[model samples]
Target: MKIDIVSVFPEYFDVMKLSLLGKAQAKGLLEVSAHNLRDWTHDVHHSVDDTPVGGGAGMVMKPEVWSECLDQLLGLDTSAGADEPSISQGPIVIFPNPSAPLFTQADASELSGAQQLIFGCGRYEGYDARIPDYYRAQGVDVREYSIGDYVLNGGEVAVAVMLEAITRLLPGFMGNPESIVEESYTGSEPLLEYRQYTRPTSWRGLDVPAILTSGDHGKVDRFRRDEALERTSQLRPDLVERLDCSQLDKHDRAKLGALGWDLSGEHPRRTK
Candidate 1:
């Protein structure tokens, strides 16, 4: 896979170039590049932002530099359709923002299959609104994802997150594929599962669950599912609805019900 990042802070990309992603590049499985967004600037200060058109709190990234840089890198006219894949092309413009949509495991999986992925990191309040609209007109799907509820200084961190998340999902990135499938949010189960540990048999007076040491896969799976349900109901119940309980037999529901779990209704304190 080929990944391109457009950001003012190109140096921030060193993290990606030095870790697992770096190894991927070394193995010839991945090609990643970070371009300084200001390179397209023609001014002495290389100014890329200006005050808002109708008086806003912060400056907006200028569209000219972005358009020129994108055009040169993509080797296409500014009005060209971004989705037109010829002999070699990939998805471009995965922007990070507060709106747009939420990034999910499905999105990461889809990105892992792409031949090329481009990220546009904006700063100074926001980018020229027209950029996304323009890309949308060209039938290109530009994803604007928010990492969380809170906002960040810029999209650099968001880009880092997206890169790592998508990169790790690629084949051979990890030694064990089961690790991904059984991960916290990878499978249909959206909640954190019950996990037990092995130690002094007791830790701070809290002993590990007895079922974990029984060496019974059936019992352990049921215990883990029940614990997952309890934990989700207590912490992030909103996720419980998304979990795939089809794997659960009658035993699973009975265990959860015995623990005062109300899976049929929203959590007592609903946030979603």
Candidate 2:
């Protein structure tokens, strides 16, 4: 996949060269580039932001410079959509905004299928809202997602977080593709992964679950399923709320019942 990042601090992406991401680039599975947003500036100091129009506290990124940068990258002749690249020719455009819908594993999985993606990193207060609206009207597939509920100093960090999530899902990117198969937030059922243990069965004082070392795969699988259900219900009830109760077997329901989860409804809920 091809990935383009537009940010004032292009140096931030240098980390991409350090790990599996770098290996992906070397293997020709990925092509990544970072472009300085200020490169499109035509004036001295290459100013890209100005005081907000509605007397806001912080400066808002200027759309003029952003438009020039995006137009070139998106192969659009003008902001009005002139000579706009088609779905096949253009890449998906994304912006990281704290106020936008939260980014999720589902989103990452979907984007891993795209051939190319361009992420615009916002600074200061943020880029003009019109930027995304304009491109969307021009028939570009645009997305604005927030990594979390809180805010960040800039989009670079959010881009990194999202990029890692998406790129790792690409076929052959991971040394062991199976590593992602049973991970949390993946598969038909999104649940936290069961706890893991390494050798030395016995740790400093605690020991690996007896079931794990019993050589009984059936009992071990049941133990893990029970643990995952309780762990997810305890820490991420929101995910649990999305569960399809009908899919839970008698054994699964019995375990959840012990935790006060009411599965009679369309979605699971903790009674108390």
Candidate 3:
């Protein structure tokens, strides 16, 4: 997979060079590049942002700079990645903003499969809404997303969050394939396993759960699932609502029934 980031702070991505993503590139599994959007501007100052037109408090990123940078990066008019036939399929363009759609774990999983990902990281105030609006009009698979209810100083942090989330899901990025299957939000439940303790049977004062130490894989698996379900129900009831109860066995159904989860919830009924 290939990923290109367009940001004012190109230096912010230097950390990617020392981590798992860097290793992936070295192994020829992933390719990532970060470019300064201002480099595409024609002005002497290489200006990429300006005061809002209709009356806004902060500066707005100029659409011209974004268009030029994106067009050149994707080889829209030139022979860039043109040799790569998949480039024409279109890049997944993501615009980070507070008012945009909420990004979920499923979105990250889906994006990990894209041939190319192009991130438009906004700075200062934000981009002219036309940036995302125009892409949407072109049938481009662009997504405008917000990390959470809170706002960030810029999109750089959000871009980092998104890149890491997608990268880790790629096949070879994480050495272990099993990690992806058991992790939080990978399947039916969005909740992660509850807190765990290890070794030193008697810690500062607390003891490790005996169920974990018992060498019986069957019991341990059951215990962990129960803990995960309990944690999900307590902390993120919404996630519990999203699980298909029909697939659950008698034990799971009984447990959930006791917790007030009925047949009608956020998820579809299990098929088999």
Give the top-scoring candidate (TM-score).
Answer: 2
Selected candidate, larger TM-score, 1 vs 2: 2
Top lDDT: which candidate number? 2
RMSD of each: 3.8, 1.8, 4.5
Clashing pairs in 1: none
CA lDDT scores, all candidates in order: 0.77, 0.92, 0.81
Taking the tens digit of each residue's C-alpha lDDT, what string does model 1 give over 15-47? 887877888888888888999998999999999
Clashing pairs in 3: none
Residue-level lDDT tens digits of model 2 in 1-272: 99999999999999998789999999999999999999999999999999999796999999999998988888876546546544436689999999999999999999999999999999999999999998899898999999998999999999999999999999989999989998999988999999999999987998999999999999999999999998998999888889899999999999999988899998888898
Higher-scoring candidate on lDDT, 1 or 2: 2
Ranking by TM-score: 2, 3, 1
Angstrom error of the Cα, residue 206, model 2: value is 1.6
lDDT of 1 at 124: 77
C-alpha displacement of 17 in model 2, angstroms? 1.1
CA lDDT, candidate 2, residue 74: 83
* Per-candidate clash tally: 0, 0, 0
Worst 10 residues of 1 by lDDT: 263-272
> Least accurate stretch of 10 residues (summed lDDT) in model 3?
263-272
TM-score of 1: 0.86
